[model samples]
Target: MKFRKKVDKVLGTSLAIIMGVMVINVLWQVFTRFVMGAPSSFTDELARYLMIWVGVLGAAYISGKRMHVAIDLLPSRLNKEGQTKLKTFVNWVIIIFCLAAFVIGGLRLVYITFTLRQSSPALQIPLAVVYSVIPVSGILIIYYKLSDIINKEL
Candidate 1:
């Protein structure tokens, strides 16, 4: 559990750094395009790549923070004992579905692209690099969900 928390913190920090880099890349692109009259073709591509990293890494951070959008009305209404039970049920359901969709669908997407040997158009980077985030992010979600369930039960 402690190890997982540490990993989550590392991933969160990496996400923050990637987001910062993406912002800086966009700023540079704008400055060069307007002020210097020399727009960069590669910056956009880099930004896009960084965006993938940001989103995947950020998902785990948001999950850890409990920041994802939720309709809390139902949970908010329950009595304390009922609420605890319902919360556990909801956590289990969430873990099942999230892990299933992310693992199954994400794997399919990556497999198709990998078999095709595709690459990004402007960046010329392999498609696998772009799509690798799917599984990494998915697995992270699975791990965190397991942690949540364990913590709740204990």
Candidate 2:
């Protein structure tokens, strides 16, 4: 419970900060392009990178909160035990998918990007740095799913 709360706080803060930066960057891009007759190339690239982080982090945060969109129709009608079992099964499936696809695949991508020394064209930031969010968020999702399973009332 305590760990979940802490994770939630950190993730929420990170999302908020990144979203704020993205908003500002977009506004600046607009202002410079239209009013100043000059466009900031870096802002667009930075905003795109920030959006990727925000999306993955936001997903992890939602997983922690068990707020991800789901079809609750059947579960809602089921008995407590049935509902618990259904939720557990679904959670396990999600965990497995995250492990296989996000953690494993994302790590592979990160390694490739790092080895190739790939960098964003506009910002010159390492692509690996941006791609790192995938595995990190996958780990976070696993943590939250385990926490949810353990703390479930049913």
Candidate 3:
């Protein structure tokens, strides 16, 4: 539980920082384009990449809080025991999906991007750096879900 709380704090803080930077980047981009009459070259790409991080990390944060979107109709109708079982099953499903889709697939994507030396045109940074968030968020989600199971939060 302490570890979970720490993870939540770190993820939340990191997301907040990334969002702040993204907002500033966008504002700079606008200021440059309109006020300076010459748009900064890297701002757009930086903002886009920061957005990707914010979105992926935000999803993990939401999962940790058990605040992700869900249809509660079935669970609402279930008895306590039934709801517990259903929630556990759903948690496992989420874990499996994140492992397969985010961790495995994301690693492959990151590897390929690194191998090819793909980069954003404007920022000239490796694309793999941006894509790395996929696996990181996947692991975070997996950790949160496993914690849920272990803590019997279902």
Using TM-score as the measure, the top candidate is 3
Candidates' TM-scores? 0.88, 0.96, 0.98
Looking at candidate 2, what is the lDDT of residue 19? 94
Q: What is the lDDT of residue 47 in candidate 1?
A: 90
Full-model lDDT for every candidate? 0.80, 0.91, 0.95
Query: How high is the lDDT of residue 15 in model 1?
Result: 82
Superior by TM-score: candidate 2 or candidate 3: 3
- Tens digit per residue, CA lDDT, model 1, 32-89: 9999998988898899789878877687678766677878798788888888788678
lDDT of 2 by residue, 45-79 (tens): 99889999999989999888778899889999999
Model 1 weakest 10-residue run by lDDT: 145-154
- Candidate RMSDs in Å, in order, are 1.9, 1.1, 0.6
Clashing pairs in 1: none
Span of 10 residues, lowest total lDDT, candidate 2: 145-154
**Candidate 2 wrongly placed segments (more than 4 Å):** none
Query: How many collisions between residues are there in candidate 3?
Result: 0
Q: Tens digit of lDDT per residue, candidate 3, span 46-92?
A: 98889889889899999999999999999999999999999999999
Runs of candidate 3 exceeding 4 Å displacement: none
Q: How does residue 73 of candidate 2 score in lDDT? A: 99
> What order do candidates take by lDDT, descending?
3, 2, 1
Off by over 4 Å in 1: none
